[model samples]
Target: MRKINKYILILAAGVCFTGCTKFDDDINTNPNKPAKVSGTQLIANSEMYLPGIANNAYGSLYPQYLANTTYIDDARYTTVNFNFYSLYYGPLMNLESVINSKTLDGNEGPVENQVAVAKILKAYFFWHLTDRWGDLPYSQALKGSENLNPAYDKQEQIYDNLFLLLDEANATLTNSTGAIKNDIVYGGASLSWKKFANTIHMLMALRLSKVNENKAKTEFNKALNAGIIDNNAANFVYKHLAEETNENYWYTSYTRQGRNWYALSKPLVDLMQGTADPRLATYADKNAKGNYVGLAYGLSDAVKVEEYSLLGSNLRKQTSPVYLVTYAQALFAKAEAAKAGWIPGGDAAAETNYKQAIEASVRQWNNNDVTGLDNFLTQPEVAYTAAEGTRKIATQRWVHLFLNGYESWSEWRRTGFPVLAPAPNNNNKQIPRREGYPTQERLNNTNNYNQAVSSFPYGGSDNLDARVWWDNPNK
Candidate 1:
């Protein structure tokens, strides 16, 4: 009996030792570094990627808003392909995680709202991608190891899916309550997001104008009726904070590093100066001579930096705001729609929208100061003429879209306005219409890449000169 009792005691001691080992493991684990990030955290990660477009100096060179002072390769269109790998691996993947997350972010917001925002952002990223690269892995994308080598989807098909995703998001937000947590863009305001989604919807519809006018008109009208961003107060801007992590890219370049590589292009300066556009005060800074002189874009020889105006002081500040889509953009879209007969009231309404768009843009850039606006509007070149309405609106829209490179570049491709001349020493001898597919696509997804290249519309080839589907009016 004594031996059996001793054996039982030894067994109990062994069990206690094993349990204590497990407890020690639990206590040593780091609580701050979560095993799985919450949906809110993932969405915040996605928002961090918005500044890429705003700070794209290369993209700005394409539209002639920025001139390369010493290095002019990009301005001369030397680079043919731009990698979008970071976009997919970073923001897009993070948003996809939120969409697939089974656990709700309780008190942060309803699961529906969280998922809806993710879907909206996902659609936006895809929209930006397709505009730059015509065909992409849409349906099969973000599948992780499930589909390692995904086939590239046609741009047309991708557009269809984007529309569906946006629609689903808008509808899902209707019944959802509570502000989304970690929402840096709209600060958890669900209504603002709804308006922003519709604004994107309208803009996408307009892209189809040249290729599919009927469809474009129908979609544009639908989005307009559904409610888009109509006022400056609700403009979508990426507000950079006064911290290292969120400081404006210009601040890092000019202030921190003392680099002055970019200057306002002659084309932009001449246009603004010609019309005495009031926004020029805020878009550029005076040179050493106290004059707003611009640099000749894509110059092969280096010029004296101080002879030309650099970026405005406001633009280079640590916390300078980057406007994404603004009320001015929405108004310009409406003005174009009206002029195209997509909306009611015709040219008369078009004129009204055009004037309002300029006013809004002027107010936005000049800190609501309209000191020289009235006179500037009456200038012959600045006045709205129904006969030249299309060219007029396109030109003004380009002016208002200063520094927002991708959108301006896309607009130049679509409208053929402002009459940009190819750089004198350009490699292609013409402004590139589209970027070539990344080299990784050819190496890793050979079959799919070959198929996409061969299927290019309007006899397009996989080159910088080749036009995307929407850019091909002949198609």
Candidate 2:
């Protein structure tokens, strides 16, 4: 009897020791971080990356709207670096949690409304990811530790899913009851969210204009009917706080860093100058000669930076708004759709949308200067030309999309308009179509990354020249 009791006590001691070492550790929470956060809080945090990871610098150089004086590599298409993990870990994860907690635990306010918002944001981030780098870890992504190595989903599938997400969001908003708080972008206005979701849907539909005409038209019609931002009053822009922590990244990069690294490109300056575009004065500052002078794109560092104009002070303002998408951009897309026969009413409709786009863009930058807007649009070169309508529309968009580089670059790729000349003295000999996948993916997620890149057009060496799936119009 004594021996048996002794054995049982020893077993109990072993069990307690195992619980302390393993079970307790697993169950412990880090009080510093959230075990669960409010849906609104998660949304506000996710909204921080709305302008995206890489901003105007990458976009401007690729589209030949801006040039780098010192670091000519980005301009020359030599050093193409972009990372996707930030999106995966940051906004995507937070959004996924919002949806999951709302659906599962039922704690988030008005599950339908919060879930809808989460879906919309998820679609937006995924759209950027798949567009920037063809094929991404989509369906299985944001699974946390359950599935660390998510499979790379095809870009086509991703687009299809994105459309479905927007459709559900639009429908859900119709009957939504709750409000999303701390909405840094929309101030929790559901109507603005509708315009934003539909606008983004229109943009995504236009993205398919090159690859899948049928899908493009179908989605375009759906989004246009649902409505989009009609005026700058409805634009999707994030005005930065005056505080340091959340100040505009561009302001920090340009002013605080003390680098006049960027200047307007020759193409943009000349085009605006030729048309006497009103936005030019807002877009750039005059050089020492009191005239707009731009640095030639892809110039070597040997060129003296002081001779050329620095970007306008507006961009470096602490509270300058970051353009995510604008009413003007949506108008331009509508014009393109009408021109392409994706919508009804032909060239006349296209002309209307095209002109409205230019007018709206001018006013957005020029503080509602009606005379300047009217005069600028009335310029012969700026007027709607039916014969070269597509080029005209695309060119205006290239200018209108200033500072919002990624979209401008994507527009250039899709429309093949504004016919950008290849950067001179580029080592690659061809313009980069997609930013290269991060080196970390190659090292850690080796197998999946290899499998994903292998599916690219160039047999997956992760080259900068590899065109993203949508970049090929003929595909």
> Which candidate wins on TM-score?
1
TM-score of each: 0.92, 0.89
Candidate 2 off by > 4 Å: 1-36, 103-109, 174-178, 457-460, 473-475
What is residue 282's positional error in candidate 2, in angstroms? 0.6
Candidate 1 residue lDDT tens string, 338-420: 99899898999999999999999999999999889999889888888899888899999999999888888888899998899
Instruction: Give stretches of model 1 more than 4 Å off.
Output: 1-37
Q: Weakest 10 consecutive residues, lDDT, candidate 1?
A: 5-14
Against the hidden true structure, what lDDT does model 2 obtain? Answer: 0.79
Alpha carbon deviation, residue 431, candidate 2 (Å): 1.9
Estimate the overall C-alpha local distance difference test score of candidate 1: 0.85
RMSD of 2: 9.8
The candidate that wins on lDDT is 1
